[model samples]
Target: MTTNEFIQKLDGLFAAQEYGKVESFMLSALEEAKEKEDYGLYLSVGNEMIGYYRSISRFQKAYQISEDMLLLMEELQMDQSAEFATVLLNTATAYSFDENFEMALRFYRRAEQIYHLLVSPDDYLFAGLYNNMSSLMEKMDRNEEALDLLMKALAILKNYPDRQMEAATNFTNLGLLYLKTGDCNSGKKCVMQAIGMFEALDTPASHYSAALSALGEICYHEKDYEQAVIWYERTLEEIKKHYGFNLAYAVVCENLANVCREMERQGQAQEWLKRASEVRKRLEGENSGELHDIDNTAAVVNKEEKTVKTGGTKQKALERCREYYERYGKPILKQFPGLQGHFAAGLVGEGSECFGYDDSISADHDYFPRFYIWLDDEAYEKYGEELRAAYQKLPRHFEEFADTVMTPEAVSRCGVWKTTDFYHRLLGRQTPPETMYDWVSLQETRLATVTNGEVFEDCGGGFMAQREVYLSYFPEDVRRKKLAARLRKMAQMGQYQYARCMMRGEYVAAQMALAEFIQNTGSACFLLAGQYMPYFKWMHRKMKELSALSEVAGKLEKLALLPSQQDKWDEEKPERYRFALNTADEKVALIEEIAGRIAVELRRQGLAEGKDSYLEPYAAEVESRIEDPVLRMANLV
Candidate 1:
């Protein structure tokens, strides 16, 4: 095919999420485009390749390709073309995914400029730009700005004739905005309208699911648990049938679980809760922060008696928080009149009581009827201190809860923080860093320590969206890229170097190879987690709980300590031989465990988890150990 034809075809495949086919086709197509000196086709193919990289979330590769594409576009002075505008918008989206807000905003504005110059008055493309801009504003906590932009998009959508899907999306977004701003009525109106449009559209589209989900969210906020359950059930079914099970499906499951809990249908709630847990577990594949939420809910549903409840103090505290929310919260809403997304008050987790599961111990310090004030990262950054101050001024010394206080510093430390802080604390960085070691360590740390809060998850998607962003597996192409790298590393080091060291009687070096193999395999576990581990610690714990090597973390610890078998080494010693064999066996087990986890996570994601039939190939070189006695050293490195 001609380069332009090939580029167009590749763009079509990318839109279809056929990411796997992108590289092979693009390599050949790019070759042809370069050979034919087709600048337009070259730009198209380059941008399309960037999109493919982005969809699977290879941000670095996407950015690299985008830079090259942008330079080429500049070289050709092709920024005036509609295709170039679209490419700029797409590249901005790539930056947004990585939380590179500044760069994303730059590209988005540039695209808007180009789009305005290119498209006609009633075109729907601007609707998309506005929607995207609004979303970014929301992410940045620019609530008022986001709302204004959303309204503008709604206005534009209303003028468009053949943009039902975009219109529905706009309405849904508006509904969510209204819900966030405290205008539930307006939110409901917008959501139901969107749902109506979706039903009337007469096509099998994903927006119907999104609309149903939005309606469910509205019902949930209204405390209409029964209606909420119905909407959520429909959404769940539609999502599973049409989109299959994914992060969105998992979200509906969580909402359904919550609805069931609210309705006091403990049995049904438990069932749905279990389903939600499984979905969460499968999605995250490792324990994450949401584990505490699940554990608390499960405990409540299971009728486990609380260890401590001092004279209905808990209930009284909840009541006070609710009262404040109803009173002062409403007044605040009157001022904005568009806040409707989330309104909750609780002290569920992240306090002394949460971990202790008892109240009798101490209220000595700062423990009172304290409540969290949650806003999305964007809003929090802009108006968090103001909100905190406002919350503090609200009758802090209530009756017996006179010890109540809301210090600004305390609130700053206490309330739901920005995604950046949340991720950095959990994952060791604001953005997922680029490198295997960084990925592994971050996954381990994030999975190990995400839940330490009495989070007022007024952020609608809450744990759900966060899970998708951080915990969700790497996009396919990214996974393939990482997998290829890992395979290459393993082949070079594990398959070749270890055997060579053993053959050369380099016992110390051989042990080092074995240690390297274990570390690499452990790193692979992190890869699996990075790719599939969701935003909950408990889910990660569960995966580790299921692993064969999980029980042997202690053994591996000991293996790290056994003295090197160098000068006075005797492989014939029973204790040394036992340790060596056992260590080797355990290393094999660890590799197998990592492989198993990878396979399970991939299968859950509906991707091929692993091609290896067994873990033997990934295990330490047992044959080489036997042939070279000196190399069969124990715990050298």
Candidate 2:
């Protein structure tokens, strides 16, 4: 086919979602490019397919394609080009997703090398590279180095104008760092500034949503449930209005339910709780015994009458877990005789019913006869295949269970593994080394917590030592970039346009700002999720498990429910809309406060020096430049 027709055909295939056809066509194109010695076309075709492979979870093929691209770049001696940088970044990210952090880091550094050569010192692109590097450092446990890099990105942004959001992001991250090190005041200031900027700029829903969510977390930690509930509510509204029944919203709602439950808002709390439960049921679809209700509440009983009955024991659950382990455990041990890792033989930690408290309700789900296999790095080196084979041989169907849920293969394979070895397989090392800056970003997220689950061994303490590594957190620079992007957009929408349009009765214009707000906030949440060790899709899945905050999922759904102008725009709809908006605003305020605290915390932790100014240095700088501090501070500029 002629080139244009071929291109048209390829586009058609892509539009049809015919992935295999797309791959085949692309491969043919690659071959043709090679024959023509058209290096640029070869690279382009190869790069596109590389992304396709990665998208389909074909990591090995993706890795192979990346290698081919790298070789082609080297042949052309364009290793320092943006094209090369792009490939490198793509390759590193792909590897990182596959848990091959070492190769990912190496390529990421190379991408940075090229990126630095082209971008200005203070540019967002440079900040992005620094951010990625800092994340890698956190994964590696080089906290000090990560901190230094984050500061460098912050310093660069400080000197650059029109970098309000970026600076705010840096401030927020700095706040996270402080929180990590137990420096609450500084962290609060930084996070507050970030929230302010996002609100002012009319950021996407998730940006404000994340900020508010963090604020709720801070409040929870401070034992301030009222404030936490308010922020959580706001976060819930934003996520509901934007993401539309997505997992992130569900999780946030679940979290909000927790805040409500803690604050004695049982009526409101139950609403959220019910939503969370429904979402989980939907997500579980066909029930899997491995599904754990991490934040689920127990059956309610009269507080004064049956406190003992209401408060379930962990021991009962343990017995069930042990029973399953015994039934299936022996066979796994026999299959992998070469195992010598930390948890080579049996179950421990969460599934270790012998060492656990029994909670009968826990057996409703996630409780099963399963155990994790532990191994040291050396045993994996010698007997990885045997271990894999043995683990895969375990029965998929378990008979004689109250809930005959299918056990996920991932968890079933768990009994034959060690925590450190697993991490090494997935994260390129046993642990991730995050900088103080990374910690700042991470404190706003759950990636670290998820990755930190159920460590099965500490043989020689090597695995435990690496716990400091792979501490899935965001880098300061990336946070800054995203924050800056939000600020710039928010300014174009919320502060500058929304109220004026509303006053003018220009509902469409007002709605546009709302749209802008939704987009920015949604992206922000994704950004927060991205910094951690979990894959993006998985993060969304886990978020939905939070049954308490499912209202956010409602809000996300509502965003797409646009009203027609021919009919007087539903006045009732606006009230419902305002509910979401008000909630989002509250969330924004909470997040901003959290960001401020983050700043204070970081400074106290010594990751950053005191700026001797207001809540945020960058905000103060902008405020100082504004002709009217009141108008500027009020977000009227």
Candidate 3:
């Protein structure tokens, strides 16, 4: 049979949902084409087989066939053709599914190079390539690059009316990317659009269910438990309606159980957990990751039930450390009478517990009765190992807590260390930054880590002395340069690009611009308050505690969670258009209001000489106040 005739028969089988027959039929076709010496039919059958195997998650089989197909193409002197590029794209996707990301990227790039030579910019082939390659980029954590490629694919796909499903898939991909980057507004908008498109086209239920699950995820992260449960239930129903008790159904059931647990509806949570466990057992077997995850959720539910029965509240890890220290650590150190004055002990460095942010969830790893003991370099050389051994001999169980089962990464977080080495591990240097450039380059989070937690004792004052240097905040010049850079970013991302992207209908890009604006504005607030911003996870929590510009954190959070105006923007009704325009105006006004607040703080601090509400002029003024000519002359951002 000809390639077209074979493809028609394959499509008929797929449409009939005769999935069990697909593999054998495709293999027979492939062999028959090979026997007939029909290269076109053979390549066509090979591509079909690769896609079929990949769809069934048989990635090794798909990859093996892809290798065979490529070798055959090269042997036939067809290595540079569009057909070869198509095979390369399929191979790359197979590798990606198998989690061999670097190899996937290599194949993707080779295919992209061939496509650039053989295809037009707006070709549907290029769109497919871009869409597939974007998935690989996202998996590799190159999010900005992934976003750009997805946008390119969307732009090209928009020109092909028959490719609406592809365009909708791109929207789904874009939404997930935005969600990954914490741009929930854009993510929700894109996902909703994809769902709408899928519904209108009457596409496969799986496509619709996936989008619903994504929406459920967004709600879960936003703490909208009611809405999360709603979306997840709908997704579960969709999956059950078409796919029965499959892995997707099990996963959605698991998601609902998690949301129910978060809502404290333990009975409902247990019901969902049981459902998921039952489906997982039948569909995925006992050894599957899905089963393992369900087992974990069941364990957590049982733990919470036990906690409730005991009338106990989870103790903060820092408090536990101090109590443990008082009970054991102090007496242990007293055993080393000669070295007592040389030791400084505290719980600090590289854990949520150190920052006092640890919760019940943290106990799975690195949450134990642990604290650091710092010794002077010479004292450590003499007694560090001895002290560590003594520390290990302490009672492992205290109160309701015990020594945690630690991963390899959590081994050294607590223990005896030379004072210099502890700081070196965290900051990549034993001493504080000595130069203006060094201060500017030092990550604020690193400084925050160095200064966090209580120094329980410091008889020699060595550890605290070194920490004091970091606690002093940035020098005035370095602060000005950093503040100026943050202001410039706020101006560019929030005040300028946000509006520009909105006008261009690039809602995802607009949301990213706003997210950056919020981030930099938060950083600027910390700079203005003469504080180090903690890690990203804790920045908002710490910002709310700042005496200076504390209200700005709430405003930034409001801006981030604002609902997208995409529906109104696409609406033809005049009232809807007006509503979208009004929302857009409100958002811009909020952005400027934030800028205005920062501008006032700048003048109050005497870092800038401007009454203007716009941040760019204030940024320029702040840069001008930098006494260090080197930083003043450097790029603003």
Please, what is the TM-score per model? 0.42, 0.39, 0.49
The whole-model C-alpha lDDT of candidate 1 against the native structure comes to: 0.56
CA lDDT of every candidate: 0.56, 0.53, 0.78
Number of the top lDDT candidate: 3
Candidate 2 lDDT (Cα, 0 to 1): 0.53
Per-residue alpha-carbon lDDT of candidate 2 for residues 156-184, written as tens digits (9 for 90 to 100): 77667676666666665566566656767
Model 2 misplaced stretches (Cα beyond 4 Å): 1-79, 86-107, 119-123, 135-142, 202-206, 240-254, 257-637
* Clashes found in each candidate (C-alpha, N, C closer than 3 A): 29, 104, 0
The sequence of per-residue lDDT tens digits that candidate 1 reaches over residues 451-514 is: 3333433435143344435433443334334443453354445444544554456877867776
Expressed as tens digits, the lDDT of each residue in 1-637 for candidate 3 is: 8899998887777566665577788988998998999998998999887776665455556756776786677667787889999888887887676555655766788788888899788899989988888888898778999999999999998789887788888888889899999999999999999889888874353467778898899999899999998898788767655445565677777888888788888866766766675675554233344433444443555344433222134656787888888888899888788886687998877888888788767777767777889999878888888898998888767785755778897768888988889988888888767788777778888889888987887877289888877875678778888888899899999888886677678989988998899889989998876778999999998887654577788888887777775654453445554343334456777888888878765643346656557788888888888787878998634
Which candidate achieves the best TM-score against the true structure?
3
